[model samples]
Target: MRRVIVIPARLSSTRLKEKPLTIIVDKPLIRWVVEGCLKTGEEVILATDSERIADTVKDLNVKVVYTPSELPSGSDRVAYALRDERVDHVINYQGDEPFVYTEDIKRLFKALEDFPVATLACRDTEFYKDPASVKVVIAEDGTALYFSRSSIPFMKLHSDLYPLKHVGIYAFRKEVLLEFTSWGQGHLERLESLEQLRLLEKGLKIKVLLTDNYYHGVDTEDDVKVVSERLLKKLSNPTTNW
Candidate 1:
């Protein structure tokens, strides 16, 4: 089946305005994300609400769509962009995640063969447990039971066993993508301020792929500095682990 990746980018970020244009390692963050998405070898489209971001990526010879800014979340933006498209699957790539690994992306794509929706989760930290950092709980079969801003899988002793961090990447069947867009956000979605919960609330099955490696994203100016330093160091040491 044909698979396409759609990146949801907007000019209005609450913590860092015009975050898509922010540079990490002298390249626009969105460019890095699009580069990673392209590594999956799938057709990629950058869905954004601003002409600046569109033009910025256009210089990189990347495809982009002008989506409205009012969409509730990244999934909504991707759903809108893929409407009437011929692709069999769609993967929602966040613009801010410049450090996302291409191998991890391919793993999630491979996972979609057995699940309705596919995403990645990694070991959690204090940063991962923050309300701003959305969390997910997965059943033994590797299917996500829920996603929330609050910490999940309250364990008495084996809490370390379930310390999973939710990544923003998601692979969706074309129909499921459209269906998610059609449904209104649910109560759990509102309480946690996470859209993925709406899918769980609707009984949709989401596959959770675990990975040992993950990357931090640029959310604020401080985040930009940190990611920039990391990317620079990564570039400096080509043999270093990602």
Candidate 2:
């Protein structure tokens, strides 16, 4: 299938201001993400509403599509940017995940061959109890049963078993992505603020691809520093795993 990756960037990020332009080591965070995506050699497009963000991507000789600022979420922006394309599949990769491994991207794409939508998940930790760490429950067949910001499964007998943390990466068939944008916000989606639930509510199938590799995504100033330090460590020790 013809595949493309779209990074939904915006000028106003509530957590870190103008996050896409934030410098990580010697390059903007988005540039690192773009480079990682480049490793896959799939066509990539930056979907944004700001000229600053657009120009930044252009400076790197990367393709970008400017969408409206009124869009409710990144998923909507992705749908708008991809509306006219004849591509068979699209990957919604968050701009903040600078360390997104090429292997994870390829894994998600491979999972989508039979799944309507595919995403990454890893064993969770106590830190994931925070509502900000989105969690998911996967069925034995590798399908997602539910996605939530809160802890799922409500372990009646708590033990060392870890939950799954929903990594922000997602892959979908072109038609499924367009259909997702058309779906009205469902109750679970509205309450949880998770657009993926809207797809599940509409009876769409989502497959979960399990991975153990962890990448820090920039959500706050601290996250930026943390990821930068991690990158620097990797740079100094080329053999160090990220």
Candidate 3:
């Protein structure tokens, strides 16, 4: 299937302003995300509403699609950007995930052959209590049952349960993406403030793939420092498996 990666970047951020242009280890945060996607050698496009963000990546050898500023979410911006494209699949690689692994991206692509939508998740227990860390519960067949900002499957009595941290990376069939954008906000989605729930509410299946690779997404100033240090280490050790 023909596939392409689309990154949604916006200048306005509630926690960190001008997030895409924020400097992380001498390079813009968006630049690092774009570069990581580039390692896959797939066509990459940046979807944004700001001309300033467009100019920042002008020399990156990637296409920049200008979207409207009123788009509600990054997923909406991505759908608008690929409206006229002929791609069969679109990977919504969030601009904030600078530490996204190319291998995990490829795995997500492969997963789309069997499922219409797929995402990456890694095992983690430390961040389960943190609402910012989304959690996913999967069925026996590897299909996601639910995605929540709150800690799921309350370990009220069990100590062996560990939560899966949902990675922001997603691969969507072109038609599915369009259909998702057309549907109104779901009750669960609106309440949880998690967009993926809208799909589940619509009876669409989302496959979850467990990955060993760890991804760091920058949402606050403290995240910036953490990502910067990890980025420096990755650059220094090119052979390091993520």
Best by lDDT: 3
Candidate 2 is scored at a TM of 0.94
Local accuracy of candidate 2 as per-residue lDDT tens digits, 1-242: 58899999877889898899999899888788887787777789899998887776675546788999889898899899998888998899998898767787888888778988998888867546789889998778988889998888687776454578888888999998998889799999999999889988888889988887876689998898899899999999989787
> Which ranges in model 3 have alpha carbons more than 4 Å from their true place?
156-161
lDDT per residue for candidate 1 within 124-180, as digits (tens), equals: 766545777777887889898888777676655666657678887889988988998
TM-score of each: 0.93, 0.94, 0.95
The residue pairs found clashing in candidate 1 are: none
For model 2, state the Cα shift of residue 113 in Å. Answer: 1.4
Alpha-carbon shift of residue 203 in model 1 (angstroms): 0.4
lDDT of 3 by residue, 68-159 (tens): 88899999999999999999998999999987666778888888899999998888898989999999888988889999888986877754
In angstroms, what RMSD does candidate 2 have relative to the true structure?
1.6
* Candidate 1 deviant stretches above 4 angstroms: none
